[model samples]
Target: MILELKEVHGYYDKSHILNGVTLSVGQGTSVCLLGRNGVGKSTTMKTIMGMLNPKEHCKTEGSMKFDGKELAGMKSHSIARLGIAYVPQGRHIFPTLSTEENLKVAARAGVDGSCKWNLETVYTFFPRLEERKDSKGDKLSGGEKQMLAVARGLMQNPKMMLLDEITEGLAPIIVDQLASMVQNLVAEGVTILIAEQNVKFAMKVSSDCYILERGAIVHHQATKELTAETRKKYLGL
Candidate 1:
C-alpha cells in the first residue's frame, strides 16, 4: 500500500470524531472516501496530511504510513515535503497572480530530484490553462479555476495526491473534463486519494472504494465488485 491508515481515531475537543477509521491506497490508482456530510472523510485526509494532531491530549490513536514512513507524529510541512500534495475543497488559488505565475510558484523538484510536471507538460494535458496563462486566477471561470488547482498540485511533482471534494460545485461538462484529467494522471503512475459525496462520480473514477459512516469504514470493495444496489443503499442516491 502506498498509503495506509490502521485503526485510526481522532477527536475534536471532548467530542470523538473519528473512530477506528482504516483504509489503504495502492500505487497508480484512485480511491474514494465515500460518505454523507459530517462523516470523517475530510478529517481522514487532514489526519494523513499531518494537519490534525491525533496525539493531542492522547485523544487520538492510530497508525498512518505513507510509502512505509510513519506519518502520525510528523508536522504538516514535513509531510508535504515528503511529496504528498493536497488540493483542498475550495479552489484556493492566488487570486492576484496570473495563471502562469501561480504554476511557476509551485514548481519544484520531487523528493527524488525529479519533476514530471512543468509548464510544457501540464499545458499539454490542460490546453485551456495554456490559453489563460496570462489571466489572473480571479478572472478565470469555475472550470478553469478547478483545472488550475489540479495544475498547481502537479507543480509540486508529488508522489501521491490527496484531493478533497474537487467536484463540489463544478458543472457536468467541467466535471467531465476534470475526470479525464484525473485518468491521465493515473496513467502516468500518480497515486490519488479523493474524498467525495457524489457516489456516481466516484463509481466512475475510482478503482477501490471505501464507505465511511460516522467516522468508521463500513464497506470496502473493488469498484467493479460493487453493485448499483449497494451504492444506493449506502449513499442514499
Candidate 2:
C-alpha cells in the first residue's frame, strides 16, 4: 500500500469527527471515500495530509503510514515534501497570482529528486491551463480553477494525491471533464485518494470504494461491486 490508515481517530475541539477510520490506497490505483456531507470524508483527507494538528483541544490518534513511514505526528509541510500532494475542496489557488505563477509556487521535484513535472510538461498535460497561463486565478471560472488546483498539485511531482471533494458545486459537464483528468493521472501511475459526494462520478473514477458514515466506514468493496441497493443503504442515494 502507498497509503494506509489503521483505526485513525480525529477530533475538532470536543467534537469527534473520525472514529477509528481505516482505509488504504495502493500504488497506481484510485480509491474513493464516499459519504454525504458532514460524514468525516474531508476530515479523513485532512488527517492523512497532517493538517489536523494535535492542538490543546483538537487531536489525532492511531496509525497513518505512507510508504512505511509513520505520519501521525508529522507536520503538514513535512508530509507534502514526502510526495503526498493535497488538492483541497475549495480550489485554494492564490487569487492574485497568474496561473503559471500558481503552478510555479508549488513546483518541486519528487522525493527521489526526480523532476517528472515542470512548467512546460504540466502545461502540455493541462492544455486549458496552458491557454490561460497568463490569466490571474480569480478571473477563471469554477471548472478552470479546479483544473488549476489539480495541475498545481501535480507540479510537486507527487507520487500520491489526496483530493477532497473536488467535484462539489460543479456542472455535470465540468465534473465529467475532471473525472477524465483524474483517470489520466491514475494511468500515469499517480495513486489517488478522493473524498467525494457525487456517487456516479466517484464510482466512475475509483477502483475501490469506502462508504463513510458518522466518521466510520460502513462498507468497503471494489467499485464494480457497488450495487444501487448498497448505495441507497449507506449513502441514501
Question: What TM-score fits each model?
Answer: 0.94, 0.98
lDDT of 1 by residue, 1-237 (tens): 989999999877687779999899998889989989989888888888877664564345799999999988888889988989888878888999999998998898898988778999999989999999999999999889988999999999999999888898989988887787888888888899999998767777789999999999999998768887877888786
> Model 1: C-alpha RMSD to truth?
1.9
Candidate 2 lDDT over 1-237, as tens digits, reads 999999999999889999999889999999999998999999999888888876656789999999999999999999999999999999998999999999999999999897988998888888999999999999999999999999999999999999999988899999999999999999999999999999999988999999999999999999879999999999898
**Model 2 stretches astray by more than 4 angstroms:** none
Clashes of 1: 0
Instruction: Give me the candidate number with maximum TM-score.
Output: 2
Clashing pairs in 1: none
